[model samples]
Target chain A: MEEIKKHVLDCSNLNCPMPIVRIAKTIRTIEVNEQIEVTATDPAFKADVEAWIRKTGHLLISYAEEGRSRIAIIEKTK
Target chain B: MEDQKLKEYIDALVEEKVNEKTLAFQNQLENIQQQLSTVQVRENEKITMLVTSFELDKVIPAFIIANGAASFGMDVTLFFTLWGINALKEKSIYKGKNIKEKMITMMLPSNPKSTTISRLNMMGVGTSMMKMMMKENNIETLPDLIDLSIDMGAKLIACQMTMGMMGITTDEIRKDVDFGGVALYIEEASESNITLTF
Candidate 1:
């Protein structure tokens, strides 16, 4: 098995649009094909991230729920 | 035999003309489809807002949305008109040219920080309480949100007509604010997928 390095973004306690906005901003600082792991407490995190990925043509590698936090691993395709 | 040959030649010519016409129509359809798709892409990539209120609660959401949209890589524009123009005013007191202008300046909130909520202002007491609550909740303050929006590339456009009517000078506004008229707002709003008024 191979290990992949990922950038982590913590959006705990942030409301709507903040998590998505932060994620969008963070994705730009990394290289193409790099992955970002985002953990957010906002309930809409899953849907927001999905829509963002769809609109921006990015890749969502995986998503999960750990208690109150919704986590998403996204890859910058472009 | 000559009549039969003539009839066959006319039929062949008609078939060829019909095929040519069909091909031309298909090309036109494809061109229109391509144009439509381009417009959709542009619409999805932009957002425009008309901020017509100076109330703290209303103005805060405007900046929040602007910052959020900018984060999503959308072209965001905030068109400030009328009372909303106060949100971009400099904190310093402006000495107007005449008494009326001076009164207007004195009456309006000096800047974003001084703005009070539309309801339950209670002579600024409620506004203070709300500010305290926001601070406790870890929400970004209005001034910080405005700065964040600008840093995120959200365009802040002050309505020139409103500024003139209110006797506000370019020096009274923040340095980074852009000044424009209704035409600019329409130009931005026309291409935006989401157009909001606050």
Candidate 2:
């Protein structure tokens, strides 16, 4: 299997727009098809990430939760 | 009988031509409508907010929305006028030349940190309690939110007329803020898809 390049973004304890905003900004810096694994503790992070991905037309590889932290792996398609 | 048949044939031809023309016109209209809807979507990507109040509750929501929109890749403009201008002021000890200006400076909060809530302030106790709660919840402070909004590319425009009336000098305001008047606000608000007053 080919190894995929991925980046990590830690948004622990951040709420609302912070996680989404940082994701949007970070997506621009990486090359297309690269993945970003974002971990945030905000309760709304999962829903916000889904909405953001829908609006921005990105691909959500996977989303999971660990304790209080919500994690999402998003691929930058554009 | 031949003449009658000829007349009927001509009428049928005319009706068919008219129907074809009408269908073409309708298609053209649909294309134009699609183009117009696309333009509307593009224009709606911008948001303009008019902040006229300096109360902590009001200020927090304004910045939150502004920052949120900015983070969402929307163009956000925050126009500060009257008491709202105080949110952009630097927290410093400066004296005004005239007594009225001095009094105004003394009465108004210097910056977002010192601003009081609209109701249940109880001599700053409520504001303090709210700030403590926000801190405990990992929520960003008002000052931090303002800075983040600016950092996120939200345009901050201070009302020049209000500054003149309140005797707020340019030096007292943050250097990153742009100064404007009512005309500027009108221009931004007209182009924005969302216009809110706080």
Candidate 3:
């Protein structure tokens, strides 16, 4: 198996549409083979981020709840 | 002596570099002009204009758009109707003379707020707070905004259907408003590139 390089992203203070927008932008700037781990605190982050991930045809490896914050690991397919 | 001569030579080279940059900028300007000449913009450019029937947060954008479009030389019309009609009501609402208006303002905290905040715990509290804040800030309430819209030729039209549904009559509506049906609105909006429902 090939080793996957990953980057961590923290978007705790962002509101609706902003977290998704920032993540999409970050994904575009990364190399095709790398993955990004996103962390956010907004209550709507899970559904919002997941919806965006599905819409953009990206992969959501896993999502977890950390206290008030929610975290998701996503991979760039392109 | 030789060092002094070298410094003079460097100064001359810097002056020549500056001249070269100026020429390059001039050349870039000419290139831009050439590109502009070849670039064709459509004769009939579509412009988007918003039509708002809601109050305050919604109406503010309409006013801003109308002012912006008029300033930009675009044909802009904002049609105020229904509750928006109250905005055009006599400025006396803000003057505290109308007991009915005062009662409605006092009772607004109990009514359902805008659709966006109805599900929240604060319910109409946010809207109530907004109204109070506007009064304190000397911001025009919904009625005053309607008056402003009228003064700007924003085309305040009371919806015949809405008024009929609400059992409101022409006598009840403010004097500045022109009553119209959906067909008239559609006719006016036909030439518009932008139409928004608030």
Candidate 4:
């Protein structure tokens, strides 16, 4: 796997769609192909982010669990 | 008439009927596909709101939907008419030029954050308790939701007629709000697949 440049977004304690919403807001700022590392505390977001990425056609590079939080690296595909 | 001629005539009639039915079926299929395309386009393009109530419960859900739609790249317009117009007032209740307006704003919770719950509001205690519960649960308050919606590109439109009736001038409302009438709401709603009246 190739190394990808990423931006970090903290969505601590924010529920459900908030984490995904924040990711949607931030993804537009960076250029296409650049990834976002979204850190979310809500347990539901593990599935929610995947669902959103699938619906929006964004690339979900990876999703990792760190302590109690989940981190998803999503790449924008133009 | 000869037997061969009779048989040929019957065959032609049967072929014509089949062709007609096939054409009709194809046309119906095309119509259904067109309708589906229209619905899909409507789904992705816009979400418009006709909010007639400023009650915390109503406005909270409205804001949630508006912000959700806007975050997903849909154009969101919230039309505030009637009591819904109150949601556009500034956070701090200022002394109004008109006494009636001033008194009303003052008597109200002074801001959307302080808006009373629509049900079981025990002399504002319910509102406070609900706010506390929301805070404890990491839920976004009404003010936070409104700001997030604005940041996500949702348009807040105040109905001109309602504002006139309530004696609220454009300047009295918050700076971020736009002015509109029924026609504007209709125009926005027409383009939106999801149009809700609160």
Candidate lDDT values, in order: 0.88, 0.89, 0.60, 0.83
Ranking by DockQ: 2, 1, 4, 3
Q: On residues B1-198, what C-alpha lDDT tens digit does candidate 2 reach at each position?
A: 999999999999999999999999999999999999987877438899999999988989999889878866789999999999999999644564588888888999988889899998999899899878888988888899899898889999999999889788998899899999989999999888899999
Give the worst 10-residue stretch by lDDT in candidate 3 chain B: B109-118
Each candidate: fraction of true contacts kept?
Answer: 0.48, 0.52, 0.00, 0.41
Residue B121's lDDT in candidate 1:
89
Off-target runs (Cα >4 Å) in candidate 4 are: A64-68, B1-44, B91-107
Total clashing residue pairs per candidate? 0, 0, 1, 0
Rank order (by lDDT, best first) = 2, 1, 4, 3
Tell me the interface RMSD of model 1, in angstroms. Answer: 1.7
**Quality class of the docking in candidate 4, CAPRI style:** acceptable
Among all windows of 10 consecutive residues in model 1 chain B, the one with the lowest summed lDDT is B91-100
Write the residue-wise lDDT of candidate 4 on B44-92 in tens digits: 6788998988888899899878877776778999999888887888754
Tell me each candidate's TM-score.
0.82, 0.82, 0.39, 0.76
User: Which is the winner by TM-score between candidate 2 and candidate 3?
Assistant: 2
| Model-by-model DockQ, in order | 0.56, 0.57, 0.02, 0.45
Instruction: Give the residue spans of candidate 2 off by over 4 A.
Output: B1-44, B92-96
Model 2 TM: 0.82
Q: Which structure among the candidates has the greatest lDDT?
A: 2
Better of 2 and 4 by TM-score: 2
lDDT of 2 at B9: 100
